[model samples]
Target: MRINVNQTQCGFVMKNGCYEKMIFAGTYHYPACMGYKVIIEEMRGRVGFKEVPLKVLKEDAAFMSRVTMVEVPEGQLGILYINHAASAVVTDREAAYWNVWEPCELRFIDMREPVMDRNVEKNLLRLIAQQYYKKIEILPGEMGLLYQDNILTDELGPGTYYYWLYARDVLCRIVDLKMKELEISGQEILTADRVGIRLNLTATYRIADPKRLVETIKGVENQLYTRIQLIVREYVGRYRLDEILEQKEAISGFLAQRMREEQEQYCVEVQTIGIKDIILPGEIRDIMNTVLIAEKRAQANVITRREEVASTRSLLNTAKLMDENKTLYKLKELECLERICTQVGNISVAGSGTLIQQLRELMGT
Candidate 1:
C-alpha cells in the first residue's frame, strides 16, 4: 500500500488497512493527525459516519472525512481512500487559512507602500482582470487610475503580497522623486574658509522623463537634484562674489529657468531651488566693505567741492555788482552812517553833507 501527501490535490493520504490502523492509533504521528487516529473506525463516530471500507470508498473519501473530523493535527493533509470520493482538508484548527485561500493582489510602485482597505484584495483582483480581460470593475482605495496597458501584466502576475515588495504604480515619474546634493569649488568664486564657496543648496524634483531620466541619471529623483545643484554652481562660477551676493534675485531666477530648460528632456519639474546660505571668505567680505566705504567718501568729497564752487561764484558776482555802480556805493555810505548813528546815539555828519552833495550830483540835480 502506498500513501501520497499533496497539499495542492488533497490534505492527507491513507494507504492500506494496516497503514490506516496505524494512523488511527497515532503511530504515524504526522503533525496533522498527531493526537488523532487515521483508522476509519476511530474517525467514524466522531465524523458522523458509520463505516468506511477501503473498496467501497473513493480516493477523496478520506480527505472529506478528515475535513469534517473535529480533531486532526497541525498541517494541511491529503486523505486518500480506495473507494471514497476525493477531497482536501486543513487540519490546523485556526483561521489562518482565510488569507491562504483568499489572497490579496497588490503592486508596489516607486518604493511607495500601497495602502489597503477592506476591498483591497478584491480591487486588486479586479485590476488584474481588467488588465488581462479588459473588464471594467471598480475596486476600493482613493488612488486614481490612469490607464492600463499590457506592460504591467507582462511584468507581475497574480500573487499574495506583503509590505516593501517591488511593483510599478500607475503614473510613472519621468524622474524619481528625491533630493539631490552637490559640492563645488572654484578659484574665482569667494569661499567661506579658503578653498571654495560654501553654499547649501536644496532642490526638490520629480521624474519628468521616465525613460531618459532613468537612462541618464539611473535614479531620476536624486540625479535631478544633483544636476540642478551643479547648474547653480556653474552659474555662480560665471560671476564674481560681489555679483552673486548683490544679485541674488537674478541668480535665483536664472537658476530656476535654466534648470527647467536643461531638465526638460527628463520631463522633471524643479519645484524649488533654494540657496540656503552663501558663505563668503572673511577677508573678501572685509575688503568689499572697505571699498564701498571709500567709494562713498569719494562721492561726498565731490559734492562738497561742488557746493564750494557755487558759493565762490556767488561772492564774485556780488563784488562785481558793487564795483559797477557808484550810486550804489553812495547809498551804502549813507546806510552805514545811519547805522553808526543809531549805535552811537549821535553822529555829526561831516561826511553826510558831502555824501548828499555827491548823491545829488550823481542823480543830475
Candidate 2:
C-alpha cells in the first residue's frame, strides 16, 4: 500500500482501525505482506479544519504560531480541541473498531454567554468590519480576562478587541465592574450595655483591580460581605445602646472607614456604607416607649405648675390694686352688682322696695 500527505494536509497511521502515530506531509509505502497491515488517511479536510481550528500549542506569552501539522505522542501532549480538552490515544484493534477514543478528566468553567447585537449590520459593513474576521466585545461595566491555554495572559478593559482566532486557544472572561450592593439583614448584635439588637446594613462596592480581585479574593462578594459584617459587629459592640441609637451615622462612618482601609488589599473599593435599620428587641422597644411617656408627663407637669404660679401672681396683683385704690374698689363692686343683676331673675327687694337699695344695705353701704 502507498500513502501520501500534502503540505495542506496531515495523515494518521492506523493499524486495524487503531491509531498508531501521526504523519506529516510525505509519501510512504507499506508492503501488503505479513501482519504489518497499516492504513494512513487524512485526519480532516480544509473546510472542517477551518471551522474547528487546529491552533498552535501554547508555549510562552509572546509565542504563538499556527502550524499545519503537529505530533501527538503517546500521552505526552494535550490540547483544548473544539471547546474541550482532549488527548490523542491509540487503542487496540477491537477498541478502535468499536470507537473507544475518550477524553480524560476535564475541568469545566462557567463561560459567559454571548450577548448578540441587536442592530442589523449591512452586508458591506459586516464584511468590512471585524465581524467578518474576529470580534470580541467587552461591554460597559465589564472587564475581560484573556487566557491563553488556561493561563492568564492579560486583563482587558471595556471595549472591542480582535485576536487571531486560529493561532491559539484564546478565551476572554467577562467580570462585572459595576457597583455591587450587599445587604445583610436582621443580624443580631450585642451592645456594650448588654443590649441585643438586630441590625441591617447596605454596602456598595466595585472592583478596583479585576486581576487582583480574582486572584487574591476568592468569592469577592462573599468576602466583602463577611468583612463588613464583622466590622459592624465589632464597632457596635464597643458602644452602648443609647450611644448607638444616637450615633447611627457615626457607626456607618466607622464601618466605611475600616472597610476602605482593608478592602484595598483585596482589590475592592467600598463606595457607600450605610446602616439601613437598627431594630430594638420587642421588650426593649416597650421599655423605651414607657420611658419616653414618663419623660413627657414630667415635662407637662412642670409646665402646668409654672402656669399656675403665674396665674396666682396675677390674681394677687389685681387684689392688691383694688385694695389700694378706693375708686377702683367701688368700680369693682359696681361691676360685681351688674354681673349679679344680669345673672339673677325674678328678685324682690324689701325696706326701700328697690333691688339696688337692698343690695347696698346687704353690702353694708
Candidate 3:
C-alpha cells in the first residue's frame, strides 16, 4: 500500500485515504484499512504498553520512541515527552528529566514532596540540562544540590569546580523551638534595641536527610530565622543590661555556645557567634553615670580626710619626741648661740664658759 508522510501533521496517509499518526513503536508496514494493526499485534503481550492507545503515542514523540515497547521495568516509569522537537526525556522518578538530543538541557521539577538528600545533585544536573535559569529555593527541611548549566565536566579547572559547589543551593534550616516558647512567655531578660550584641553569629548547615527535612520541616528557612531571633532575645535577656553593654564579648561567647547546643538536632554547624553591639537604655545609662561620679567623689573625700589626719598625727609625734629628749634640749641651746654669733661679728662672754651657767643661776635655774 502507498503511504504519504506529512512532517507538519506528524502522520501518514494510506492509499485507501485512511490516515494514521506516527506512534511510539517500532516501524511497521501495514496493509490498506489496517492502520497501525501490525504494531498493535506486536504490543499485545506487553504489560504497560499492551492496551496503550495509538493516538496517545502520536502526541508524545519522546515517550513513543525512547520508552521500551516491552513493559516498563520495575522502579522506572515510562519515558514522557517534554518537548515536541523529540529532544528531551522526562521520567516520573525523582521528578527528573533529561535532553539527550541537546545533551545540555536538564530539569528537575519539584513536584514531589520535599526531601533532603544526595539525589539533589542528580536532579540539579538534570535541571541544568533543561536550560532552566532560576534560583532553586531549598526550605528548612529541604536540602539538595543544583548545577547552573551543563558545565559539569572533568576538564573544568579548580576555580570553576569551586564555583559550582559554592553555587549549589545546599542550605538547611535549624530551628530553636525552646527559644520560641520562652519568647511567648514574655520573660525577656536582656532587652536591647538590637540582638546578639558584639557577637557575629553565622550558621552553616547542609541537608543531612533531604527526605526527612522535606517531610518534617518543609519551610525551614523562615523558621530558622525566627528561631535565631528568639534565641538571641531570650539568651540576651538573661543577662543584666550592664553585662550586655559592658561585657559584649562575653555575651557573644555565651550566645555562640548556646546556639550550638540548641541547633544540634537540625544537623547544623554554628561556625561562629560574634558580639557586635551592646545596646543600653538611655535612662539606665544616665543613672550609671551619676552613680559612678558620686562614688568617685566619695572616694576622694575619704582619701583627703585620711591624709589630713595623718599629717596632724605626724606633727604631734614629732613635738612629743623633741620634748622627751634631754640631749635635744642642749643641742637647741648651742644652735641659739651659733645663730647669735652669725648675726653679730662676735658674742661677748660675761664669765667665759660659765656665762650660760651664771645666767641660769641668776634666772633661779
Candidate 4:
C-alpha cells in the first residue's frame, strides 16, 4: 500500500488493527501482505487520535514535540490560544492541540471568585459558553447587589459583572439611586369640621444607604408611603376646611419634619413632600364660591360709599373757600363759562348782566 500525506496533514500507520508509528507529510510504501494501513488527519487544529491511545502517542518523542496538552483543573476554565490569540474555551478536564498550526497555549482562569477580573479580555470572554457564567449589567444611576447561594456577597456599582454559574446559584438585584417621585392621589379624609376632602400628595426621595435599606427593611417604598399618608391625614384632620385651605404650607412643614425624624429608619433622604392638589366636595366648593362673590360685592359697596363721602367733604371745603374769597369765586365762574362755550359750539348771551353772572345763573350753580 502507498500513502501520500501533504504538508498540512499527518498519517498514523496501523498494523493489523494495532498502532505502529506516526508519519508526517510524505509518501511511504509498505507491502500489502504486512497488514499495514494508514489514517490521515489535518494537523492544523485539535488533536484526537482515536485509533491510538494517548499513552501510546506520548511514548513517541516526535509526536509529543508536535502536540500541546492542556490540563484544566476542576472548577476552572482553560482559555485556548493559537499564536497568542484566544481561539476557544476548554471546559473539559484536559484538551490537546497540534503544534503544526501555531504556538498553542492555555490560560487558566479560576471560577471560585464571585467577581470576574475586570482586565479579562472581551474577546476571550466571547469564547466561553453562556451556560457557564451569569452576566449582570448595572446602568448609570443604578447599583447592583450580588448574591451567591441566596446570601449577600458584595455591592457593586454601575458596570458589567460576570460570575461562574457552575456549582453555585447567583442573583443580582438593582436599585435606582436617582431621586424618585411617589404620588398618593385621590386620598379621602375628613377635616375637623367634618368636611370630606380628596388630597393628592407628591413626595421626592432618594436612597441614602442602600446596604442598610436591603438589610433592615423590606418594601421600603411602601413603608415610606404609608408613613407619609398617615402624617398627612393626621395634620389635615386637626384643621377645619377653611383653616386647612389657608395652611397648606403648615401641613407640608409638619409632614416634612416627621419624615426627617424617621429618615434613619427608612434609609432614605426625603427631598421634599407637599400636597399637590386639594379637591373639595361639590357642595362645599359651591358654598365657598358663593361666599367669595358676596364678599366681593360687599367690598365694592364699601369702596363706592368711601368715594362718595370723600367727594362730599371736598365739595364742602371748596364752598367754604369760595364763600370766604369773592375774587376766587369770580375766577371760578369765568372758568365754568369757558367750559360751557366750548361744549355749546354756538351761544348767545342775551342777558343784560355780565357774561359770568349770566352763565352762573343759567348753570344754576
Tens digit per residue, CA lDDT, model 2, 159-234:
8765533334677778888988899888889999899999999998888888876666678787777778888887
Error of 2 at 101 (Å): 47
Q: Give the poorly placed runs of model 4, Cα more than 4 Å off.
A: 1-4, 12-23, 26-40, 48-62, 113-119, 130-146, 153-167, 170-173, 261-263, 350-365
What would the TM-score be for candidate 3 when compared with the true structure?
A: 0.34
Which of 3 and 4 is the better model by TM-score? 4
> Best-fitting candidate, measured by lDDT?
4
Q: Top TM-score: which candidate number?
A: 4
Ranked by TM-score, the better of candidates 1 and 4 is 4
Pairs that collide, model 2: none
Query: Residues 1-365, candidate 1, lDDT per residue (tens digit)?
Result: 22343332222233442234222222233444443323333222123232454333334444444433223333222232212322223233421111122232212222233332233334333223222122222223211122223122211212322221224334312122344443332223443322356676666565444444433555555556557656765677777665667787777777777887776765677666666677766876788789999999999999999999999999888777778987777786777656765788543436668897875664456
Candidate 3 lDDT by residue in tens digits, 1-365: 43343322123323344333433323345665554332221221121332334454446655445333323333222333334322334452322232323222333334222222344445344423322222344334323333233322222111111122222332322223221211122223434543322333443444344334444565655665566666776777666565566777776677667767866555445545654434335676677799999999999999999999999999888668769996876676667666765898754557665887875654346
- Scored by lDDT, model 4 comes in at 0.86
lDDT of each: 0.45, 0.63, 0.45, 0.86
lDDT string for model 4 (240-349, tens) is 99898899988888888889999888999998989989999999999999999999999999999999999999999999999999988988888887787789777666
What lDDT score goes with residue 64 in model 1? 42
TM-score of 4: 0.80
Error of 4 at 277 (Å): 0.6
The Cα RMSD of model 4 versus the native structure comes to: 4.3
Runs in model 2 lying further than 4 Å from the true structure: 1-135, 148-164, 330-355, 358-365
**What TM-score does prediction 2 earn?**
0.56
Query: Which residue pairs clash in candidate 4?
Result: none
Q: Please list the residue runs of candidate 3 whose C-alpha ends up more than 4 Å from where it truly belongs after superposition.
A: 1-157, 161-225, 238-251, 265-267, 326-365
